[model samples]
Target chain A: MNFKLWVKPFENLAKKDRFTISILWVAMVLAYWLITTAGEKKFFPTPLQVWQGFAALYSEGLVVHIGSSLWLCLQATVISIVVSLVIAYSYPIPLLRPLSRAMSQLRYLPLTGITFYLTILVTNARTMQVWVLVIFMSLYFITSLLAVIKDIPQEEIDHARSLKCNRWEILWEVIVKGRFDYVIDVLRQNLAITWMMLVTVESILVAAGGLGVLIKNSDKFMNHGRIFALQIVILLVGLSIDYTLNTTRKSLFRYSKFN
Target chain B: MNIQYEEKDIILQVENLSISYGEKVIIRDVNFIERNVVRKEINQGQVVAVLGRSGRGKSTLFRALTGLVKPSSGKVLIPDYSQAPSNGMQPAKEVEEGDVGFVDQKYTLFRHKTIYDSLTFALRKSGEKGSEKKEKVMKYLIEWGLEKVKDQYPNELSGGQRQRVAIIEQLLSSGHYMVLDEPFSGLDIGNIQNARQSFKLIENGHDLNTIIFSTHDIELATELADSIYVMGYPRLDDGSLGTVGTIVRHFDLKALGIAWRTEFTQDHLELVKEIKSAMLAS
Candidate 1:
């Protein structure tokens, strides 16, 4: 073993060594939990107990709940992406700049306060849940996208003007088409925010039986083991989504890596 | 052999131009006129170089020339091709954005577009259609030796290929006028040679084609530009250097009997020295 290689800062590890260290690190975490929780504790559940709880939930229609949450999340995310892109891309126009600016700043407003108004306006439970998630994600998405648009170099716009592009064409070509990859990146960032809000939105409308409803039920009955297992599942799904978006960005915008 | 050339009617005119941001003046009192230069036995066009030190508002002057920035005081004029010439003189109008094409030092092509697609996009305003537009862009791609890299993105191209694409993009879009800001600032010998060839490709296309560029290399400026303008801070009444940039010297090489020559002679070196002294003084 090259001991110095492991000790040095910012040093690269061999792939085999990296894999070995990762596995060992996970094992160490598991061993620490087992060692520390010798006696039965109220809040802390053993790893095996959590696994059994997960298996029980899996048998009792957990897959349906996961699918329901995923479907709702997808709907809200799609709406957010489209709406945010429209506002952000139109930000350069003098007439639309103020509107876009106000929309981007909406992230600071309390989601619960907006939810009160949305419940009054939107009568249907499912529609209200979707709107809640959409509002939450769209605000953050607009903020991220506006930053990306703002960072675009002025020379690109000047180059477009030199090519005889009118104001609308400049907005389309330079501001919209030129920054599509950055849009995808911003989507990736804001998708995480959407996922974080998914449970809260789903729990508010329990008529829609979803992962959030399952979590709320487990919490109400003091089923700590089941709650931990469902939390683990939620974390894994979020990670998988993040991975997929990262791969999509890498594959679609191969040139973005150059920047 | 005396290379016979006639200076005809004005092609571009910048009259008493000044640009500023609030209280700070960048370039002031910048005035120059470029006329069509027709040479016998060969096709030639104007390659005017604006030589200046860093931060002397060469970029501001270029922004005005390209109509990207409105001048604070004066106007830039070019022939209004939308109207016909009256009594052997083309109708002149104030320049607007998109009148002159500009390529910066980075050779900034759209990062997402391939060379072929970028050229196609440049022709968006052109009234050509379908296969005709594609053919026109393809002809340029082939002639400039960029056909092989047509499908490749800008990052996939080398420095020379990107430069050609940038120049041709502007050539096809703006037509007749192209401005390059520090085209040769960070180039090596081979790449610089490629840039020189790119200039020829542009000049060979049209007699009215003009390439106005800025560079710090005195020797390269003398080698490329038939006319040179030195921009720097001028002496004030109190003998202090002024902050506002203005053209302090103009070298009309056409009158010096040195332009269009196959070689840079001792006279060119002497001229470079004179330009250097002028730059240092201002």
Candidate 2:
């Protein structure tokens, strides 16, 4: 009876998400054109010149810098995961809950300046950078896990006990199950924050060979094309990781909303 | 199903049991027993419901039995069986290990786990391994009408369905005496009926299965239990709950003092109209 009903499918194409997706597609196309159209040595270099620069870097045995940056991030992320897991599990013990919670809230304290100062005092650049990155990322990771644990309802705890489950069984089964989605959600959100922290860590003069260093060096030389290229590389990497993690989260909880 | 076995003479024997939470005593020297609790001499299944006004030590009795709350004074001796202490000073006695299943007043499904995971977690932890355990879990799930939601999260389930899941978890762990505390609380009529039917199937066997629960719903308790323990507020003397008097009652409709009341089909009420009438007649 309603013409709107017949046109609903087409009408949905104009909705916010679809429109946003379309806008993104157009923006990417325009960005590609703008960068390519800009002559070499201008405000933005051609995509080919940027690719050649990347190729040249790889050929010149500068790949070690990329590997170093990646290895550092990997170490930091793995350390953060282990440290946070231990903090989260330890929270159930009578004395640990409050202590862990207090430590986690301390994460809200500015990590950037803390990392900067700590790096200066430590005297060694590489070890200092790794430790600072790990410490800063671990705080947020552990806090997020604790928040998930606290969010679990008492009803769920009672249910596990009634089944004649011991303390560990109850924690593993009921408490963990009830709060895992939120825990995963927290992890996904923190991945971005971790990278930002890592960038800050890289920006320090103590450490060498990271994307942050490249960007900083380009800015100092007033090499706009190199700056743009580095920015693009960082954007692409961050976007890819964010997309993958988000998709994994959704797939893991397709039947229900985790958060 | 008739539970075919040699009934161990005294299934449960509680002698001078007392329970205190923090500084406050909840249950005190409550000497009670079901003489010939499980008797092959008489193969009859029994369900007991403990009903009382809000603060009358119903949950405390269950906790005391399982040793969750330690008894302040008296010793609880469950005949000739003792295992090492687990989670408390009292050893998980033979009677305590798999003998009692407690359905807490609060829903206790694991937050991050699905119904299937909750069930399997208990079995695996309790030294149940291999395909047989999985089969047993699957069997219980289907029997309990939870096959459809076996993979669903606890938060997604309705209160009654979650309760069923809890029951399934309990049963899968080979719990003999299912002690439910206010399981029917916060449920609608339809949910209550469904819960009743589910419970009915589980408690049908003669020897192995017995259900004991504390409930405020006097009518449902009366309908389900073979015997009922009803308590009133014990008078307080000098800041302590004194043992004054208990309005001891029993429910068997064929016997006098037990009759269904309320004219409305939809509305069920617990009134002592007939008991009072019988008293007046006497």
Candidate 3:
């Protein structure tokens, strides 16, 4: 392979070459970390120490904590997607335009501040956590979904109209059914935010005993190894979710995978 | 020699139409009428081509004709099916969106649906249901030579296949009039042949079907259209090109006795030269 091929901008490699480069880059990062942290395994704990920490976490029921986090994320994903789709799809309605636009802009607000009001409104800790995540994600989700609807080329809508579809049918055929691939794409993108907020929200309600609680407990003891280990777990789980969503999108709407 | 044909009552009419974006006039006073062209013992649809240079508002005129864009001054009228015909003439009504089939250059399709599903969805508003709907869609798919690829998604088909499917979709939904914007643009020689062949196939589908298309290729326009409209900026009293676009010249190939010929002739080349000269002056 031409080494220069790797640095060329926007270059697309064959699947085998692409996979080879990915593994090579990951190995380089591992090598760099192993070389740098050879002596002092103090502040930045070594991977071996982190592995031991991972083993310790497993003994302390890490699987259960992970299951809690995944469950919370899944619930928020489904609910937020439904609610966000409703708000975003309502953007074409003149009367509901303001409500949709307002919801889209709500993504900018700091997440923690809203939890206070939410706490007073909803008393149950678990329900409050779920609501907190749902609100946090729905805002970003709505913003993304609305943008997808807005960026739809006028040609597609015109094509739909030429097919004798009325206003409501146009909304259904063009906006909702046509671009559904992007919903899964947007979900994959916002799932990262969902996982990050999972830690933050779960930290608030310790009774939930999620990965966020484990993170909080690790922070209290200044256990850098355990925190690092939990971070890896979260990263892997997040990657898996992203992979699943991307697969679903590519399989269902085969056109979406087109370059 | 090609067989004789006669023009009947007006099928599509554009009267005193003008449209502007804010204060910038795009197309002004654009008027034309397409009558159903009936060949002796043969089904022949109307093929009206609009030829113009870039920025000449051909696209705007097409959008107006298709009722996708409302004109500022005048209206487009087509035969209204809601009412009965009188004295061999159909009643006319102002055209509205969904009244005309529009096939844009890209031939965009619903990304998620297969070709078969997309065509069925197009017929949903037609009120045809059960096996009848399936049979109708299947008939078009087979006639258009898209039966094998009917199960494929838009991404899986070639460009020409997608174009055929797009045209068939519009035909199934909106009965007759089809406005194709830049249909010949960017097509290779073979693909252009395919596109024209498909256009002829659709005409074979219905005698009342009309195709209004735009293209920059003057020679192709002369060969394909029985009636041609040349859209360009008009000359003002100051002897300068005006900003607004209009029909600077119209070519009735039928009157010239050069339409629907199997081969391009010297007369067609002469018309092409005339059109090019008109475009240059505009």
Q: What TM-score, computed on C-alpha atoms, does each candidate reach? A: 0.95, 0.68, 0.95
Off by over 4 Å in 2: A1-71, A94-124, A154-183, A205-207, A214-240, A253-256, B1-18, B24-31, B35-43, B53-57, B74-99, B105-107, B111-121, B124-131, B148-158, B236-282
For candidate 3, what is the DockQ-based docking class? Answer: medium
Ordered from best to worst DockQ, the candidate numbers read 3, 1, 2
How far does residue A76 in candidate 1 sit from its true spot (Å)? 1.3
Q: State in Å the error of residue A219, model 2.
A: 5.1
Tell me the DockQ of each model, to 2 decimals: 0.72, 0.26, 0.78
lDDT of residue A146 for candidate 3: 86
Worst ten in a row by lDDT for model 1 chain A: A35-44
Residue-wise C-alpha lDDT for candidate 2, range A114-172, written one tens digit per residue: 87678677887777777787888788888888877787775566555656667886777
Please give the range of 10 consecutive residues that has the lowest summed lDDT in model 1 chain B. Answer: B255-264
Model 2 lDDT at residue A147: 71
- What is candidate 1's CA lDDT for residue B18? 98
| Fraction of the true interface contacts (Cα pairs closer than 8 Å across chains) found in each model | 0.80, 0.43, 0.93
Better of 1 and 2 by lDDT: 1
